[model samples]
Target: MLQGNTKILLLSLLVFLLIHPSAYSQENSGTIEGTVQNSSGESLPGVHISIPDLELGTVTNANGQFRLTIASPGTYLLRISMVGFEEKTDSISVASGQTITLDIELSPLVFQSDELVVTASRRSQLIGKVSVSMNTISPEELTSRNITSLDQALEYVPGVQVHGNSVNIRGSSGFSYGVGSRVLLLVDGVPLMGPDDGGMDFDGLPLIQTRQIEILKSPGSALYGGGALGGVVNIITKDFSDEPENTVRLYGGGYEPVRFETWRAGWGGGSDFRPRGGIIFGRSHQVTDSFGYWFSGKIHNNSGYLQNSTRKGFETYAKFGWDISEVMNLSMYTGLRRNNNEQFLYWDGLDDVLSPGSINLTGNEASGANDGLSDRLTILPVFQHSINPNIQYTLKGRLFGVAFRPLKDNGHISPPKRHNKGLRYGLEAESTIQATDEMIISGGLSFDENVINSDVFVGEDSLTVRNQPEGALFLQSEYTWNDQLTTTAGVRYDAYQVHTRSTATQFSPKFSASYSINESLTARASFGRGFRVPSVAERFVNNNDFFPLESNITLKPETSTGYEAGVTYISPILDAFSLKAELTSFWNEYRRLVEPTFVNELAAFQFVNVTRARIRGAEASFSVSTLDQNHQIKLGYTYLNTTDRELNQPLLYRSKHLLNGSANSVITDWMEAGIDFRAASPPERVDTDFSLFVPDAEVFPTQYITDIRFKFQVPHVYEGLDVNASFLINNLFDYYYVERPAIFAPPRNFQIVIEALF
Candidate 1:
C-alpha cells in the first residue's frame, strides 16, 4: 500500500530492530560465583580467584564467597591460589545473562620447596629459588610437636645449638654469659635484642601468636645490619583471620632424678612434679569492608623442674588494619609481656645436683635469693602504597621498651638490686620496583635510636643513662635469565654514634646466585660480609666478684667474610613416595673476634677483640614424603671444624659433629605421632679455667637426646568445637649430659597436654 521509498524504509527498520536485539543480548555480561574450602570442608578466606587469559580476578570474602563478572560469554581457565594450600585450576564456561556457580576444595601443601619465605632476601620468594640455606617451621608443625617456646623449636634445625638461653649457629658464638649474640632475633621483622647486652629474651616472645618461624642460616648483615654476624631468625606473627579461634592448653609433667651415683648423693630434692598451663583467645572480624581487627591474650604459669626455678608470665597482642583505598593500606600492632622468675645458678660441683653455685666465694646455696622480673612492650605502625602494578612502597615505625630488675644474694657486696631498662625507637622506609619481567630492585633506609638506663653497669649507687643512634641504607637487586638462572646482589652502609665514645661505620656487601640445572636439580652459591658493633654492657660492665668482669671501651667492631655453596635435588615420585636432598659447604673467616678474656693475675675478665678465627662446615639433609602427605621423615647432619688462629686451639662450646632426625606419621584420621632425635659430638677443647667449680676436662663427652609425641583429635565431642590431646616424652633415653660444664641437662620427662579449639 506504500510507495517505493516508503517500502524501502519499512524494510530497513525491520532489519535494524532484529539486529539490535541480538547485539544487546550479546553485550550483557554473565557472572561466576563460587566458594573456596579446604579438604576438610572448612571455609577458607583470602583465596585468590583469577582468569589469567582474561585478566580478571577477585578474592574470596570471609565466608569464602566470590563472584566475577565476565565481559562476554566464553570459556576460560579459572584459577585459585592461597598460601599453605595447593593451587587449583578448572575450565569454566559462561553464557550471556547467565550465572555459573562453582565450589572448589584445596588440599594442604606437602613439599617444603613449595613454601614461600621472606627472610632470604627481605622479600617473598619460593624456597627452591632462594640462594641461601634456610629453614621454616609452620604452625601445624609447632602444634604437632607441642612446642611452647621459640628456642625449643629451633633446636631441631641443623647447625644450630640452643645452650641455656643462647643460640649458636655454625659455632659462630661461644658462651659469653649473655654479653653478645652473633645471631639476630626479630619479631615480625623488628629487632628485639637488648640494648645493653645485645641479647634477646626468648622467653618473653609470645609464641602463642606465632604463625611461622623462618631461619636464614647465612650472614645477613648486608640487609639487617649489626647483630647478624652469624645469621638471622625471624618470627612471623599471625594476621587477622576472618574466623575467630579460641584455644586452651593444660599440661603437667615431672623430672627424673639425677642418674649418676655421684650426682645423686647431693640431691636436695623437692617436689619432682611440675605443672604448666596456658590459655589463648583470638578473634578477628570485618568491621566494614575496609576495616578489620585481631586481638589475643595468653597467661601461663610453670612450676619448673629445678629447685627454686618457677616462672609466671602473661602476654597480650592486638592488630588492626584499615584499607585506606584500593591502592593503600594502614596497619597497627601492639604487644605486651610481663614475667617473673626465680633464677637457678650453676651447680656447685659435679657431685651435687641440687647445690646451686654462688657468685660469692663465701656464700652458701641459701645465702641470697636470686630472682628477677622482666617486662616488655612493643608498638608498631605500618603504611603501604602501590603506585602501580610494578611499584610499591612501605613505611613503618616501631617503639620497644624493656625493663629488668634482678635481686642477688650479695647485694651489699656487689650491688644486690640492679635495674636495667632499655628503650628503642626506629623508622624504616622501603620501596620495590619491578623494572621488568625478569628483573627487580629494592631499597630501604632505616634509623634506630637506643637508650639504656642501668645502675650496675655504669656504676654502683649511681644511675646512668646513655644513648646510641644508628642509621643505615641498603639496596638490592635480583635478575633472572631465561627463568633458569637468577642472581642477587646487595649492599648496606651503616653509621653509628656512641654517647661519649667514637663513631664507627661499616660497609657490607653480598652476592648470591642460583642455577636450575634440571627439573629436579638446583645449585646455589653465595658470598657475604658481616659485622657487629660492641654492646653497651660489653664496653661498660663493671662487676666485682670472684670472677670479676671489667669492660673495655677501646674494643673494636668484629667483622667476617663468609662463603657457601649448595645443591638441592628433588627426586621423581616412585610408588607414591618422594625424596628431597640438599648438601651445602660453607667457610667463614673472622677478624677481631670478640671474647671475654680472663686476666688471671688481676682475677678479672675483660671484653676484648683478641682473636682471628676460621670456621668451615658442611651440612647434609634429606626429607621423604608420601604423595598423600600422611607420612614424612627428615634427617640432617653437620660437620664443623673451627680454629682460633691466634690461640691455635679449637673454638669453645662448639660440637664438631651433629646429627638430627625426625619422623611424623598420620596413622589414622584422628591420630598422629612423631619422633625426634639428636646427637652431637663434644667440643674438642674448652676453657675449664673460667670456672673453678667445673671439672677440668680437655674434651666434653658426646650427648644423645630423643623426644616422642602423640596427638589424638577427639571427634563429635561438641558441635563446632575441636579437641586434641597430646603426650610428649622428652629425653627418652634418660641420658645424662652437660650442655655447659657443671650444668647437667634435664633428665627424662613426661608431659600430657590437652588442648581445645573453638
Candidate 2:
C-alpha cells in the first residue's frame, strides 16, 4: 500500500519534527529588516511576519519591507499579522551580523475588534490558522460591500454561494456543464478562468481593480490544479504604493425590467525599484440595458422589460516588479479584454400584440451578436532561499497564455463568417519546504494545453483538437498537539490525459482540526475530496447530426465529498467595537453531474453525466467596527441555505435570503462617507421538459431584489492629492424582478462617480 502509506507519512513526519522547533538560528540568525506602516504612513504589502514560538515566517515585500531570519542573538519574539490589522508584538535583540530595523504601527481591526480575524494561515492563530473553508474580504469589507463582481463580492462569503453571476463553493453545482465550470479564479497568483471553460465571467471581472478578496471554500486541488474542484477565488490586485494615483468611476442602475450604465478610469506609478519592486497600470469601461419586451408592451408591463438586451465591456491590467536582492524576487503580469454583445430570445403563441412593448414583435427573430476577445500572458519567477535560518526554501515558476474568441453564429446559413477560437497553455512547478521545527512542506507540478475551435460546438467547417496532460501530487502536515490542539492531514493524487479519454486517476483526502477556545476563541473542522473532469463543451461537440465519441461516451469524472464546521472569534471587548463571525455548514454529494441533452433534434445541446445530486448549504457572516479617533463605523451580515438533492429542490439561480449591510464614516481630515444595503432571493428556474423543437423548455423567474449605495472621499491636496465620489441605486424599489425569465432584470436606475489621488 505504497510502502505502508509512505511509512505512515514518515512516522507522522517524525513526530512533527520532534516537537516544533525552528524560529531562527544560525548563530542567532541576523536578519530582521523593517518597514510596515499604516497610522497613515502607507506601505503594507502581504503583511505577515511571525515567530510565534519559532514557527518562523515572512511576507512584507511590495515596499512594506520585511526580511525575516531569527534565532541568533538573544531575547526574541516578533509577530505582526494583517487583514485589517491589529495584532502586533515586538521584542527583539539579536547579534552576529546584526541588522534589525523596525517601524511598525497597525490598527483598525474594525475599530478594535468584533473579530474579522483573517491572516489566511500565515497565522494569527484563529484555530490552527488555516486549513480550508476560508473567507477574508477586507478593503473595509470591500469598500462597504458595493461589490460589482467577484461574484457580487462573494455574496457575504461563508461557505460562499452565488449563482446568476456564478460562484458556488461548498454546495457545488457551479451552474452545470456549460455556463459554470466548477470554480477556480485567481488574479494575483494568476489563473483567471476561461482556459477552455473552467468558467468565470464575473461580468468580465474588474471589481474596481481589487485590493483583496480571498475566498477558499475548499478543494484547491492541492494548491490549485485543475479548476480547483469547486473553490478558490483569489483576486488580490491593487498595488501602486504611493507617489501617484487616479481613479474615476461611474454607475447607472435600474430594476423594473432593467437598464444600466458604467465607466471606469485608472492610473498608477512606482518608485524605489528596490523596496521589493513595483509598477502598475489599469483601464476600464462598461455599458448595459434591459428594455426587453418593448418597454413592457406599451407599458402594460410584463416585466420581461422588452426582453432585455445589450452589454459592453473593456479591461486592461499590467504589473512589473523585480528585486533580485532580498532573497531573490521577480514578477510580471498582463491582461486585456474586450466585449460587445446583444442578446435576446423568447417565444410563445402569437408573440406580438402589435408591438405591445415589443422585442421586435414578440416571437421568432430572437437576436444574437457577440464579440468577445481576451489575451493574457504571465511570467512569474520567484526564488526565496534562507537555507541557514532554520532551513528555508521556495522556488516558484509559472508561464501562462490564453486567447479565446467565442462568437456564435452570424451569417444566415451559407456564406456566414464563422469564428470560435480558444486556446490555453500553462506550466508550473512550485516548492516550499521548511524541513524541521514541526515541519513545513508544500509541493506542486502542472502542465496544460487546451484548444478548441467551436462552431457553437463544431459544425460549419468544423475543427477540433484537444491535448491535455495533467498531474498533481500534494502532502501537508501541520501538527501541534499541545498548547490547545492542532492537526492537519493531507493526501492528493490527481492525473488526467485526454485526447478523448483513457488516463484518469483521483485520490483526494484532506482533513483539518484546530482548537483553542481561549485567546478570544477558535474551533474548526474540515474534510475534503473534490474532483472534476469534463469540459470541451462536455466532451466533443456533436450536434446537428455528427455523433460518435460514443455519443458522449459514458462519461464519469465528477466527484465531491465535503464537510466543514467552523468557529473563530476575537475580542478586545465592546466600546472599541470589534466582531468577526463565521458559520459554515456544507454537505456535498455528487457523482457525475452534467446536464443538458438533446442530440439529433436540430436545436441541439448535449453533455451527459445524466443525474445524481445532493447539495446542502449553510453560511453565515457578521462584522462590526467602530473607531472613535477618526470616527469610523462598519456593519455587515450574510446568510444562505441551499438544497437540491435530486429534486428535493431549491437551487436554480441561487439567491436564497441574502442580506448585506454597510456604513463607513471618516468625517474630517479630508472627509469620507459611505452606505450600502442589499437583499436577494428570487431566481430559480431551469426546466427543459422535453425539447425537440422546443416543448416546455422553461427559462427563469422568481424575484426579489434591492440595492443602494452612496460614497464620498477627499484627503490631502498638493502633496498627496485625493478626491472621490459615488452614488448608486439599482432595482431599489423599481423591482419588478425577473433576471432570467427569458431575461429581463433592470429597473429604477441611477449612478455617478469621480476620483483622483496623487
Instruction: Give per-residue CA lDDT, model 1, range 396-509, as digits (tens).
Output: 898889888774544222242467888989999989765443456889999998898876477332447778899999999887664468899999999987546588899999
lDDT of 2 by residue, 45-119 (tens): 446777877677765543455666665466678888764467888888767778778888777554333222222
Candidates' C-alpha lDDT: 0.76, 0.52
Give all TM-scores, in the order shown: 0.84, 0.31
Q: What is the lDDT of residue 423 in candidate 2?
A: 61
What's model 2's overall lDDT? 0.52
TM-score of 1: 0.84
